[model samples]
Target chain A: MKQQQQAFALPPGAPSIDAMIAAENRRARKRLWTALAFMAPAIGFVAIFLLLPVFFNLYASLTQWAKFSGLNQFAGLANYQRLASNPKFYDATWNTLIWVGVSFVLPATIGLSLAMLVRGVKGEETFKSIFFLPRMFSATAVGVVWYYVYANEGIINSGLRAVGLGDLANRWLYESHLATPAMIVTHIWQQVGLMMVLLLIGLNALPSEPMEAAKVDGASRSQIFRHIVLPLLMPTLIMVTTVSVLAGFTSFDLVWVMGRDFPNRSTLTLSVNQYWESFRAGYWAYGSAIAVVLGVIAMSISWSLGALQHRLDKR
Target chain B: MQKKLSKLLAAVALGVTFTTAAASADPVTVFHDKPFYQSGWDGLTATAKKDGIDLNFSAYATDQFQAYIQSSLMSGDAPQAFTWWNGTKLKEIVDSGQLAPLDDLWAKKIASGEYDASSAAPFTVDGHIYGMPTGLNRWVVLYNKALFEKAGIAKAPATWEELIAAADKLKAAGTTPFNATIQDGWRGFVWFQELLLRTNPEAYAALNQGKLKYTDEPVQNVFKIWTDFYQKGYFTDATSQEEPLDFARGKAGMYLFGDWVIGLVEKGGVKAGTDFGAFIMPNVDPSLPNAVIVEGAPIVITKAGMENPDVVKFTDWYMSENAMNSWATDPGLYAGNLKAKTPNPIIAELAKIAADGKYTSVTRYWEASPSEIVLPAVEEFNRFMTNPSEEQAQKAMANIEAIASQYWASKQ
Candidate 1:
């Protein structure tokens, strides 16, 4: 490398390769600084609003900070111990797991099915818009609408009674065992639209020639879907799955608005329980611990999924 | 020219000094969680203005106000006065040394015949009264007179047996007997408080103080009665959000709530004393004293807030009977001031019943217990409401006792 640099050296009183390299390095550093200067506002915003709060929240979880009592009194590991001992926390975890598990299956399967059904069909835009309408409303509004549908005198029970199945009519949201499932159904109803749109985009982006060639080669429709389309749609599926998982972990508004007084807080997810504990019950430190646990679970799963996507892309 | 310039500079300096002085004359900010009483607060604000103290009022949703105020207090910045619940709820903040004792104000008001000593008892903590009553609400059974008439009931039930019979009659007449709900998570405790106090007031008080276990026989008996009501189909749907609306529509025979429900009922197009009438729930055991649960929200001033002279002036004027009249009459609220007149006849009648019976007033169950316990216990109470059976009641009681025991144990 040194011999090559000497061979490329400039004449005397002119710049040498080393001098030129130094000047180039200086310009590169200046360009880097310019880029950083452009990005500084966004970095500062994330540091201040997101990163700082997360770090402070981590610190707060170790302290005993009730709303008014014992502010910032450090009781190391005590909050986590309390969280471990709490049966409600465990119930919340189990409910959250059900939500996360549902996020994986329902959105992908239903979304992909609808996407395929509507793609290249007559009035496809109309059907897609109809399916996507619920996504346009806020979660709270959707909850309010569905609250009436699940209410005792709501459409479901009313329809049941009209069909001479009055005995089958039940209080859907009131039953403890049914509450989580009912809420999950509502979540899936709202989430499938986004998943469908993303998957539809991916389907449209695929090369039609490969699918046509597969069909010509005596491949069945299912075989073509499995071998040709599914592999290409993997990236969009992973993206949709990641979003659904995060949504499942962080769902609060629907459950809060719909499950007014869920039996024993049975409908409470970790997010709802955290708000209930911190804001409602004044257990700030313990709630922060629950939040930290939720964050860790969500972050680790998301990281693993992202790594999987990266490896698949490399292949 | 120099003389004219000097005069202009002096005038500017005087104007700046006056502006600074005006800015330093701070308005006393009073916070309350009652959005329904915004007009009443505005009336009080007007009255405070006439007293030369500017009053700025802020209202928050009930659920968020505690968190907002507590954090504000801990940060050494809070409004001059804010409404808070009584009993252990008040005691918790007082224990944190965030409140200023209002013993002097209480004594002054009592001496001036504007307030009663008993009205100050709920706000008393460790022998120092930390707040003044915002209002006194007595819980009573507000019955639909039309429903009662249709059910062949001549008047309000004066005994527990009669109450049950009325409920049965109402149910047979194809109307929901009571407008009961578990909505908002707090209403579940209403019947629990009502029945427990009627059955055994001492046990009710003891349970709230952590001296009586929630699984005790007295509480269990109350649960059994509640379960029986559910089995008999005497209650509207537990998850119903329309407690006041149901009663207003005459679909329910009775609604047990604070006298404050009068405004909601009237707003629902039902006249107070014409369409509906209220009566104190008779004691199940005549051997026990006549008791009523009273919910009192108090306005607590922080230590720093008390140091401000404008806040002091506003608070003093607030304790006057004139202020109470302005604050309560327009809203049909029950004023804590002894001399204040109730504009709503139903409240007046209910007040007369309590006064005539010389009823022993117990603090409400929601505010009587520690919030840490009460908030979760209400959820259990709600669970019991959803599935009201002997087994469910027992389970609910056990769960509630576990929560209460944990809270009390932590205190120890």
Candidate 2:
């Protein structure tokens, strides 16, 4: 060992720069393999569970699948044609759009306002915990609670009656014009807490230097937020908005639990309608077509948002 | 060494013997949707054991039960027997070739006068019986007797005019006259069927068979009556608690439901024939024949199950008077077996009404119509019930017709 070291060692008694560079390369290649080895199971699962089923579902949408007729009897876009003619599909699509539009306005706005209000306020953690409490409950449980709140003789009606506004105390979830909006409010009640927590994390992580600089330059609080903080918090905002949009598009549990029997199907988003057709009606192929349509709409919006996120990241 | 090896061999042989015996002792399983009938299932299982047949029973929620049974049948992993709805629903399953015909068993039971021959009609498809009646239920008006007394109604309504007068009295007495709900998404059809069948039973049957359009006059007249009832403030709010709750709590005066609801109503602390009593709804048109809607729940055997001789034997025994008594009598079910009498006073009274009047048995709308149409039609009906204006009724009727026309056109 001493003879080899004497033969190979630099005159300074350390490894040569060339040898160190080669060693660094070897370590990086080993890391690449190790990281891949660690990631292989997750990659395999995504391929099998996620991608495979999506492709199968896509194929199924083109068939004439029914409970009695069974599967694999392809009718070549007949299901889609039927869905196109069906008025309920249009109604569901309209409801989903309304939900998506509301998500863009409600959850994020409310969450951001609460985040900004409680950022450095007294008992901040307590307020945050209180706001985040609804997030801890499952969507179905929230639905059940909210169901009674909007019930005919429930809290809202009782409150209205107590104030001598009995005329205004309508069946909140029974009316077609009110049911979808009522369910959306319920969904947001459960959803905004998560949005608040997420935005709070983003706000807390924000670097203070830009805001300090803006303040010293005589910028107002609103100006600082609009110019410096907002620009810096774009990534989190994008993530939160994207998540909200997807949740809105796929709103099911609340509508199912609360407004499943809404006379006009006023609470039916595309997701709930898809479940109704598939499981309840047993029109499997028609349901698959609806799912495909929903997936396409959600995917396109997400893809556009992702592209915008990528461009912002580059900036 | 030889002795030790022999001991080890004996232990392995003994383990195999026990394993084989355990495997062979597995019970034959039956899946059912009625979770409420635990006592009846227990009694049936006890009786089955006397024939040396070990039976295992499983129950599923009504909403998910059909999907479970259908998927199981398709995958060929279904239990030997399952309870299902008869009529177009059974025909759909029979058409799928998953159900086994029980014609021989039906013939034997009918011949012995244990089961009524006419009861098999709903379960028959293409000249083959595909199911056996778990119970027979006749749709009737189960009224809150206390509410009726408060309204000063001496007896049940025997005519359409008397029914209206009773409704007015009940409404005047500060109660909703009828317990109507779209709860469970299926009860919306109750009032619609009751009105239509009472007016013209033939039209109702034809409407379900798709031979009569929903836009036809008879259907429109039915909706007209339904709308008038709503206008008079006779119905409990559609969003209120489900049946028996509204009916038993005296929130509503009359409940139009099947006789089978006696069990559930009793559970709500209402004594049958005392707090509540049933009446066969009066005909809307005096010239119309006496009719009562029949809802029969049937136990269907899979074709693979029929291959087992023991399952076939068990099925034959299941249709007998003894099995009917074991399963149905205590539960207050209206058993299809003519000889088996239910002990529940309300069911017994309803059964007597049907027998004495010899009412025409019209299939319930839920089971009479094709499922594809019924599922969506119920939603539309609920919509109409919510806003029972003439305009909304027309829209609802048009929507139902759109669905029915499509389904019928496709069949053609």
Instruction: Give one clash count per candidate, in the order shown.
Output: 0, 0
Off by over 4 Å in 1: A1-6, A16-35, A69-72, B1-20, B23-26, B45-53, B329-332, B353-357
Chain A TM-scores, per candidate, are 0.95, 0.87
Candidate 2 versus truth, CA RMSD in Å, comes to: 4.9
- Residues B106-128, candidate 1: write the lDDT tens digits: 99999988766777877888999
In model 1 chain A, the worst 10-residue window by lDDT is A65-74
Off by over 4 Å in 2: A1-44, B1-15, B36-53, B61-63, B111-113, B313-317, B320-334, B337-343, B353-357
lDDT (10s digit) by residue, model 2, range A1-315 = 557666876677677667777999999999999999999999899989999989988998988776755685888989999899887899999999999999877999899999999889999999999988998998989988888898888999999999999999988888878888889888888889899999999998999888898889999988998999889988998899999988988888888988888876766999999988888888878889999999999999899989999999999
For all candidates in order, the CA lDDT equals 0.86, 0.85
Can you give the lDDT of residue B253 in candidate 1?
89
Query: What CAPRI class is candidate 2?
Result: medium
Q: How does residue B351 of candidate 1 score in lDDT? A: 65
Chain A agreement with the truth for model 2, given as TM-score = 0.87
